[model samples]
Target chain A: MSAYEKYLRNNRLPHILCSGCGHGIIMGAITRAIEKADLDQDRTVVVSGIGCSSRLPGYMDFDTLHTTHGRALGFATGVKFAKPELNVIVIMGDGDALAIGGNHFIHACRRNINITTIILNNNVYGMTSGQFSPMTPQGHFATTAPYGNVDRNFDICELSRAAGATYVARGSAYHAVMLTDLITKAIFNPGFSVVEAISQCPTYYGRKNKQGTAVDMLNAQKENCVTVAASAKITSDQMQGKIIIGELHKSEAPEYTAVYRNIVDSLQAKEMK
Target chain B: MSPTIKLLQGNEACVEGALAAGIQFYGGYPITPSTEIAELLAEKMPRVGSAFIQMEDEIAAMAAVIGASLTGAKSMTATSGPGFSLKQENLGYAIYTEIPCVIVNVMRGGPSTGLPTSPSQSDVMQARWGTHGDHPVIALCPSSVEETFWLTIRAFNLAEKYRTAVILLLDEVVGHMRERIEIPDHVDNVLTRKKPSVGREGYRPYQPDADLIPPMASFGEGYRYHVTGLTHDETGFPTNDTEKAGILIDRLHKKIDNNLDDIVEIETQMMEDAEIMVVAYGSTARSASRAVKDARALGIKAGLFRPITIWPFPANELKQYLPQLKQVIVAEMNLGQLILEVERNVAGKAPVHGVLRGDGELITPTQILARIKEVQ
Candidate 1:
């Protein structure tokens, strides 16, 4: 059997990242999901912004677009609408997805175009020397937030669900098997789907906060995450400190492009009759 | 030369022109005074294997047109007033990224949602600078339906040639009127995209070479490339280097500026020894044409200088005629926007007379005739 990992740019392997970089893990899941779903590799387009995670496009064999900062999802929306035959994937860092491009993020979900957005939440910015991100939890110190973060973190699955995304799921790189399944399901979904992967950023986030090592960070994610059903049974007081990981939402209204096509067809048919 | 006859309203000829231009992809949400262009394109584009989509809103319509053009299709979207305002962000995007697409604004009167079904040539300046930032633009305005056909063809041609967003400024009177238009049979002579010689291997999308226009390889073409709105070098990497950023911006200006003479196309009617020249564009200029003839009959040395291409402003050519003239009457459906450009170009060489209108209607021939007589 041919190894599905053949689609990766193996020459760029043993990534240039330091230990516990979340990008490597998130990218592994996305490319593997594309392969597992048997998507047309040529017909896949990956767009990314100007974060460490954005480099995921350059490492893939697909028709990748490395766009400006915060605009990866915008370009991905265009790519998907342009050719509905193509499986469009947008990989974004937390800052690229929720901070600089927060407006576009919600709107793309609101429009519900057929795009699979994989948001890599590492809590701190890695490329710009570890700045704090919107997803950085309280008391997480970074270059920008030296005195510990006081800002509330964004739950990406909740944001995606609220913004009308048809499919919303969360997984951690620590749960490698589950990540593959979540990403695979997202890729096969017909409408807008968001897979938020809580991966490790030991070099910046962990080192600054003294979270031992990459392995420790991974263990933290595995230990902190509880089932959504289990969390629902618990009170808000119990859910305050723990993270919930599972599919949060899935339903269908018409995707934007298909609805557009239908409008044109119906207009023409009415004119003919 | 084939016989040129005037028998079409400004909008009908625009339809014929868009059809002649091989615009196979049209996605628009209809707003008035430009709805006929969308209606006509919807009806006619499909007859020729084109796809017409009435999108969810003007934003998606504008966005989809750019997407379609990137996929190697000549595409356009049309709107007026409120819809035009909604289109500027994506329009700004097109200007910044140098995407080749056409936008037709059959202008109507308003600052905000004023008169939807009425005619007004108010969007002339918006066509030039509607989108934000310091970017080059090519906005073509046609006075008649025939010029609409010709200019729409040129809008497509210039868009393909220069890689910029070209606007077709129309007014209500021109769009809904029917007339005879001889559509062009073939437009293969118009430039298609320049394919990357680097092929699919190691292709950088925004890396324009010496000519400053990079070849585009489509998405499914196996050529992985990047297009962004950031300041970047030839490798398409986002850069913070000041000198490199300046060069990239300068190249954007140079691509349009260095080729302005080919870009600025105008038609002068009897400017050899005319004492008064009435300069106008869009349907407002059609009124000026009759007024000039009426003034000539009144024994005034009045002539018409109408720009088929409103942008690249035809500044130098208009300046050439400005010095010898006593009065240059500028008339439009808007209060005063293009008049500013005219006055700047004239630069105290002559008094630039302004005849303004903003009542959701075309400036009547009589309105322009009074201006010609008053200016003379």
Candidate 2:
């Protein structure tokens, strides 16, 4: 078996993701990252909500939890608290993380637990057919918005940084190597970390918006993205129509479980005294 | 832990009972009538090496409780009406996954938070059918403070034994009312979910043994199994085959239905040869219990049939009372929720009359007697 195949559940193969869905590539990147991190399979948990990206965890050979729509982070918080030794990673979609699960997404960041969240942003509700998600670009047509979505899109990396995530980054399925590195770093971060992987949904969002084939969407991401290093030197006007694909933000903060553990230990010790 | 007698409120007893039942995690938001459960647990859980968290919303609270339970902890959450409504989504997830946890819903008047401080039994049907899909439910209603303590432990035990969520139904009256009781130092019957007997590699997470209960494996126990809300086979992975889905649904129901005798619990006093029976639960049973004694003193053949376990309905056990019962009085603090169930079970064997009070007041013993006299 290949190294990536070792991380996947062989019996559950032939996953249900769309033929041209970028989620498969993102899943590959995540598995490779997990392998690179050398995480113990018995001590790792992958939690996801209801969406195309959420389905990724089911295909992985871990103690995977496919929870309710938009509630993966809340569930992950409990898992991390109940047993702080286990590594918890959450895989979510644009709709799962930024739309229906926005409240939990922000709060999870604010709490800064040792969870690595990978937001697979296809910018549409791919699993439920094409619908405008919170990350959908303005003027993009969706099933719910036939006339094109007028709502502004969220810069997910900025949102995560503002919500107090200690480490925040953005990469794309187009940048598989960089995405893997970002995910690996996020997993190793002591506090809450988020890596937003801008993915493509050729069957829905791509077809609805006339974005040609799956390859065309990947090429577009390659042509439009600027690295964080280049982003710092470029002016705002010069960077229009360009997405940044690299580590966007990184900082240090106290992890939630560690702080809670300290509080519990001291209180119990004082009682023992 | 030491045995001590103390005057305690019903909500306080719930907290004590949860502690005795080995509850290790509590994730809840503070809602009126049920806030005391969270407040007390928050202050007390850490001292006993448990974790108490105040979630942002009721959905997260329910979700977090399930997550904690998945890690082999006895977890719980408490909410009232509107919060309970928010919790139903994840509650359905808990039901489908068969995650063992307890949810304490202290009843409050509602059609969207109608009365936060007022008590009502309007959520009786909601407690059974609040979530979207058809699933098995175990709900226990306690009539007194002492019973609340013991039943709370029973709720945990049933949840663990059946691998399902158990609702500890309380009302504002019983939750806030204080009563003196002797608290046990150590509860002997506290039960935990059974772990898989085989090694992690040999375990199929959803494969049931002789008792129709699958042995549970915690997340970090080297058993890297998958759990989903979708229809799944014995391997605990989602399946799309209609026949497989049908079988899965049937098995979920049968697991509780086939073992109804063990799960359904009801109490009866002066039921033999009684011409009239008052069927009540929760705090309302207190009045009905008294009314039965009062009627007996007056030479009226009245009896009290209290359902300690309300949801598996105890229909067959209730059927035994219909032969001699000429009239059945269904008394509750709502506009006839459980009465409908009584009427269905009685099936014209007797005249089932409803004595309901939905104006945020308890149905007094006097009103119950008046109903009995009217039926006569």
Candidate 3:
């Protein structure tokens, strides 16, 4: 068994994710990241909104909150603010983060609160049995978009960076080791950090679009993905069909809870005087 | 000794009540009438060494309170009609997960933001059945500034005790109206949630006690349990088993229903030998009270039955007055919401009449008195 196995709730295993689903691999990456970050398991909380990816927290050993659809960031903000010492990690799917939760996602990034958010962007709502999502590729087939998706997709890392997240990165489940490293850095970041894990929903997204079997979906991720450094040297046309992975952006900003603590300290000091 | 008396609006009193109840966290957005609760708490919470946050929206506010509550803090949020509508989804989440928190909805006129500053008891039905699915709710409506303060505290107590979201239902009339109240320095009867009695290894987070309420353990306490909105067994993990789901839903309702004696609160004035009984709540209850007094002096036996706990509807208690009354008149600021409950409780035992006013105005004492006279 892997060292991160202890972090998982073994009894809750035989998880509901479909066979060969990337969500399980992403969950493994999260546990390894938490372990590598040296976070206090007792003081750590995993919060998630509704989705197949959101179910990741339910099988974790940490105190987990499987909240309403598309509101995990808002809940994480409260948990972090309530106990600033606790490690707050939020998990969501593309739809959970970008569709109904779009406003909260942007606001959470803007606040720069101390939280590590991992969005498993599979481009479809798998738990709803294959609805096209905000992150779904244009012209991709989904149950809801039988004639192919007409809506534009969100570039999650770019959105997070623009919304003021101190650290923003994108990685695919096909490269689990690299994704784990990004997640570890995000957990260590002092302000809001986001990791968009481009996962494959072979059961729903792959089947709907006739994107071949589970292995084919995995192979597609590998073939399309390009390292950030490799992407920089490529022309726009060369990078058109490529998925850029690895650290997209990082910056230094005062974390929200830390700033709030300063205000609290100053107010307390004034009261004493 | 006389209590220190100060004049305060109903909203201001809610702040004091929450503070006195040791509420350590408040997450709310600025919505009309209810905004004062957040504003006052913002200035006051930090002074008391508690935390107050202005969330992005009402949905976040409710979500935040639930999150804070799981960490063992007495958490609360305040919002109005449109905001309350936004909070329903999360409120249902809190219900299914059985996380204790308080939500204050200072209702304004609304189908959709019809009147922002005006008063309406239009949300009375929404408070009872706003969130989808079969779940229990405890909503307390205050008729005055003093009642607002005490009921706010009671709301928190009920939330903590039941491990469920409790709604402190207020209206613009009660929330903004200033009245003299003797602010008690301390309340001796304030209750906090009962913590876990067993150690981490021995604890089952959702397993209920004899009273159907589980002793809650805070997040950092080492009992790492999965809390979810999905139907789950005692283990707190999502279960697809129909048998386990049935038991979970049944227990959720039974917890509150079985404990209705401690939850439901109703006050009756001059109910004996009365031919006409006025059923009212919140701000409109004040009018009913005045009208009852005037009718008594005019030699008509009129009485008032005010339900402070509006969700359970006080149906059992309302039945007691069926024998002494020829008429049951429900006077509210909305177009006959609470009257439906009264009609159900009365069950054709008496002639049930509704005196409703939906013009974003209080149901006047004159209207109630006229109804009482006509019924008599």
CA lDDT of every candidate: 0.79, 0.91, 0.91
User: Per-residue lDDT of A140-195 in model 2, one digit per residue for the tens?
Assistant: 99999899899999999999999999999999999999999999999999999999
Q: In terms of docking quality, how is candidate 3 classified?
A: medium
iRMS for all predictions? 4.0, 0.7, 0.9
Candidate 3 lDDT, B52-86, residue by residue in tens = 88888899988988898889899999999999999
Compare the candidates by DockQ and give the number of the best one. Answer: 2
CAPRI rating of model 2: high
Estimated TM-score for each candidate? 0.81, 0.99, 0.98
Q: How close to the true structure is residue A156 of candidate 1, measured as C-alpha lDDT?
A: 88
lDDT per residue as tens, model 1, B1-376: 4545557666767777777777867878878777767777767765554667666567767766766676667878888878988788778777667778899888777888888777787777777778778888888877666678888888988887777788887777777666676554554566566778876556767778676777767777666444555666765545689998888788888988888888888988778888898988877777888888888889999888888778888888887776579988888888898899888988898888888978876677898888787767
| Highest lDDT scorer | 2
Q: DockQ (Cα-based) per candidate? A: 0.27, 0.85, 0.77
**TM-scores, chain A, per candidate:** 0.94, 0.98, 0.98
- Of 1 and 3, the candidate ahead on lDDT is 3
DockQ of 2: 0.85
